[model samples]
Target: MGRYVRADGLDIWTEQVGTGPDVLLVGGLGDTVESWHFQLDGLADRYRLTAFDNRGAGRTAMPEDPVSIETMADDAAALLRALDIPSAHVAGFSGGSIISQELALRHPRLVRSLVLQSTWPVPDAYLRRWGLFIRWLAETAPAERTFLEGFYLDIYTPRAHNDGTVDRFIEDVLAFPHKQTTENLNRFLDAVLDHDTTNRLPDIDVPTLVLAGGRDSTSRPELGRAVADAIPGARFAVMEEEAHQPFQEIPDEWNARVDAFWRATQTRTT
Candidate 1:
């Protein structure tokens, strides 16, 4: 069932699946809980997976003012509190990873383990340019096909495009109901561009696993390594055949890696 959790004056759309140790799934820019559909069944048997749509995305209400990563982090923490969850293993993708970092930093007690996938600690010139390009596309050609095609070009590898995987992905994206508005897209882009957590990463004390896609030009493997290196004892792994969205591209492999890391963390804590 779908429910709304009030956080930071916004009604955030949240969904919970399975019943076990809590795992919070935070999606990327313009992504909703639906984006984690591939992971729902994969991790459900071992975890009580909770996912929510960030402000300005999905069924969640847009903020009256521009929102920052810190604000979104607080929103995530607030959602957990509202649900009476004391702590959870947090996994975040792309922009969501930045929010996850802030969550761990600001609300340490709320995060038990961290998974940062296709993430960057700070925005470089290349990333800034790409963010601007996405904003331009959102403003000029916000059609489903245009956006999906652009995303396919950026997030998937040539192997995926050659094997009709991109075609299938486009169809899936078109079927999704909650599409971000141009204004909200721009706002999200702005927030992502402003995100800088390089200096704060060392403060994240939770067990962390940084997953990088070798072919990810969006946030490159090097960036993921940097994030892992900054965090005291964070472990880093690269999915050589995947691109930005490894979880979607290689669900079985992705789920296995995450499950192994979560289990290891649990063992260590116990």
Candidate 2:
């Protein structure tokens, strides 16, 4: 069953599966708990997997005020506290990874380990330009189809685009009627552009794993490397054939790597 927890004055929608050490999964910008559907059974057998919609996404209530990465991080921490979970292995994708970093930095004792996927410490000129383009598309596009087409172009590689996978994904996304509002999208984009955790990365003492997609044009592999390099003792790996959404593109490989990383950390701590 699913439930709601009050965090930062909003009702955050949350769900859990299986039973073991907790593994909190945070999805990317505009993503909901459904985005992690591919991961539930794969990891839940060995770990208690929890996934929640961020403040502005899915069933979570959005605050009228602007939100920051720090605020979102605090939401995650608060959710854990509400559930009586002392600490857990936290994994985040894209913008969610930024929040994961802040959660670890601000509440170090609550993060047992970290898995950052397709993440960057700060936005570069290329990323900033891409963000601007996305914003422009969101504002000026004539239809939702046009916007989604542009979005898919930016996120998926030729492997997905050439094989009709993009079409299926787009169809699925459009089927959701209560999509993110333009105001919330702008707020998220602003937060992502302003995110900078390079200086504080050295303070992250927990075991960390950074996964990158070599073919991802949106969040480049070099950006992932920068994150891994900044965090002391963080390991980095690249899935050459994937793009932004590796977990969806290749679930078995993605789940195996993450499961292995968590196991390694558990062994070390024990």
Candidate 3:
């Protein structure tokens, strides 16, 4: 069931379902618990899944302070503490993946395992340029739908656009009642662009997996490879034909891959 829970001074919208080892899902920029609906449904039989809206998005109101990836990571830690989950497999996508890194670093004991999806240690020149365009569009787009279309181009593959999947997402963004404020959206992107954890990956000692969309332009394969290389034992894999949001595009396949990894971690611990 969905409800609000106080964590890190924010009344976060959180949900938990199923029964078993805990698995916490973290969404990227502009996402909510609804972002993990497929995982909640597909993997719930074997895992107790939890998800929440990050501060500045969805039902969680933006804090008066500027959006920072470290604070967002702290929020994740606080939510898990609030929920009484000592530790759980943590999976984060895109911006969420960045936040997950901080969570694992700042509160290592709170994360049983780490799954970084469409992640990067730091943006290379290519992503830096793209980030600039994203910020400009977010600040200047004529309409919400227009901004969403521009923002999604690099996030999903051409196939999704051709098949109407992206258009549907555009509609959903337009209709969402709790929209992210323009100020927060830009600040959120700042946190993403300014983030640098290339030096800290080796500090994370937990079981780690880094997933990349082979066709993704936002956080490309090379960036993901660099992240995996930095983390001592982190494994890296790519969905060759998939783009950034494969969890949304091909959720069953994504779920299966992550499930297997999570199980492997349990076996090693046992």
Candidate 4:
């Protein structure tokens, strides 16, 4: 059910399921197609959904060449073209949302609609410093779980940690075989560090929905508001109960929200 499609000079590992209007789901930093298991399972019956690994993550082997958000956007465009999809609804999480912005700007024809979750228009001073620190931590941390502990603390709410969600995820990461190398993680972070679409967001004329986690410190709600305000006619909302990952933590709620937006876009466009 999973396979590789050659795109942007490398074999991009991708998974496609169900049928109907196309939906491309892009994951956050270091995420693979597997990161979207909930969506692939929940929304596939109604929409054709495809998820893939970014250039420097997952089964898509990190290339020796430099990586950037712009190039990764190009990769997503190539993946759609290679799959014979003229255009589709595109949804992205965190870093993936940054790439989605670039994809919509660089290849506007390839994006029918955008669902940007936990996104920001650009990294502010605090966020830039945070990115640097995270990259440094990834490179110097003693153990994988050590870094993940810190990461989990920053991303998930206290409720998740207390409810055993964080513990279960740590175990899942530890048991996963396709561990992302620190080198690849740093590269991906570099791409995120360089992402800035503040000036260009207005150019994106497609139907766009920007969702923010009210408790997210990394990509704060203010940042999401700025992005929404910059983009012409884009709608913005907040999932107050979620932190960085509502789709994983509350799949049903997340799926219903995005599905409503996607179908509404289809209706208006058709």
Candidate 5:
């Protein structure tokens, strides 16, 4: 079952399942908890899985003001506290990775471990390129459509694209009611563009796992390694034949890695 509560003045919606250590799943920009449909079934039987929509997306409150990953991260902490969960394993994908990072950095006590996927330490060049793309996307429908089409190229292998999975992803995005405002999207893109966590990576004290898709262009496996290498004890892995959305592209393997990591961490803690 699911519950809705206003935490820190924002309407927060969440669903909890399973019976083990709490696992909070955070999705990327313009994504909802529904994004984890595949992974949920894969691991819920072994985890107290909690998935929710980020602010300004899905069923959560979308305030008039802009929101930052830091604020969103705090929201995450508040949700846990409200649920009486002292600590939990936090997992984030793509843009969600930024929230995960800030959560660990700003509210260390709430996060027992982390799973960061298809993410990177923000660099100025990355931000600049992203800004240009967002601006272009806002200006031209042709460009936006092109951008959406090209987005798959960055994340999936040629083989997966050929198999019609990538096509279905685009269809799903179109099917979802979620849509970001030019202002909200811009601010978010700016935050990501301005992000630079390289120096602070060493400060993360939790047991971390960094994952990347072999064919991902946005956050390549090499970048994934950089993140893993930055964390003192973080482990890094790559999903072969996969792209940006590893969990969606290869659900079985993605779930296996997540399941194994949580299981090992749980054993160690208990």
Candidate 6:
């Protein structure tokens, strides 16, 4: 448990383990730094891992009206600068991936390498439909099973979704601190949907690893392919039998691939 003051007047909650090249882990929407619990423990022995909650989630201060992806990217850059880390390997899952891409694009000097997982470049169709669902849930089903069911379908393996495992999943989400305000959630979701770096991806000089889940319905395989195709020399990998929560579903495989990717990139850079 550690706290770092960000440049944006927000006291960020962060935790670190091990000591090596910095590896910053950012979670998706409404997800706390605790969402990377498995990754933190898995990578702690080998790399310097930093996991933190974004604004409005976990212990971080929630700033209103100023929570765009650009601002979130700025927050990430500020976190690194505050740590005196000139550059670091950055990784994010789902919605967090947008912030990571923005950080790489807008604050290129602060990003050494990028790991994007279960993410897409924000397609218009997906945004229009899913964004509406988010708004509806926030307004009608705040903290209810309806929200969990829909979210699980979007973020979990089909097997998990079909297994009648709603209780535990809802419990896990309820464990986090969320406002369930449509405006707040929509503000973040819109920022994510509005962010598109496809045209600028080829210009990103940093090494990138694009990861996807074989069974992901939200950010499908095609999305991953598009991302890899856009970014020059970006490596793409899909976890077999996994979904949006691949890291949690298959920790061994996820860790092995992530560790290998980091080591290979580190060697190539050095």
**Whole-model Cα lDDT per candidate?**
0.90, 0.90, 0.92, 0.91, 0.80, 0.80
lDDT of 3 by residue, 75-167 (tens): 999999999999999999999999999999999999999999999998888888998898889889999888888888899999999999999
lDDT of 6 by residue, 1-270 (tens): 666666657788888887888899988877777778788888888889888878776677677656788898888888888878888899999889989988999999988899999878765586458767776776787456677776676777767666745456677767655443456567777778777877887878889999998887778888988888888899998886888888876777888888898999999989
* RMSD in order of candidates: 1.2, 1.2, 1.1, 1.0, 2.1, 2.0
Q: Which is the winner by TM-score between candidate 2 and candidate 5?
A: 2
Colliding residue pairs in candidate 5: 155-243, 155-244
Query: Ten consecutive residues with minimal summed lDDT in candidate 6?
Result: 176-185
- What digit string (tens of lDDT, one per residue) describes model 1 on residues 1-270? 779988657799999999889999998888998889888978898899999999999899886875898889999999999899999999999999999999999999999999999998998899889889888877777577987788678888988889998899789778877878878878877998998999989999999999999899889999999999999999999998889998987889899999999999999998
Distance (Å) between predicted and true CA of 31, model 5?
A: 0.8
Which ten-residue region of model 4 has the weakest summed lDDT? 56-65
Off by over 4 Å in 4: none
* Model 6 residue pairs with clashes: none
lDDT of 5 by residue, 239-262 (tens): 856788878877888888988898
Q: Tell me model 4's lDDT, rounded to 2 decimals.
A: 0.91
Q: Given candidate 2, what's the lDDT at residue 99? A: 95
Score every model by TM-score. Answer: 0.97, 0.97, 0.97, 0.98, 0.91, 0.92
Q: On TM-score, who's better, 4 or 6?
A: 4
In lDDT terms, which candidate is top? 3
Q: After best superposition, candidate 5 residue 175: deviation in angstroms? A: 2.2
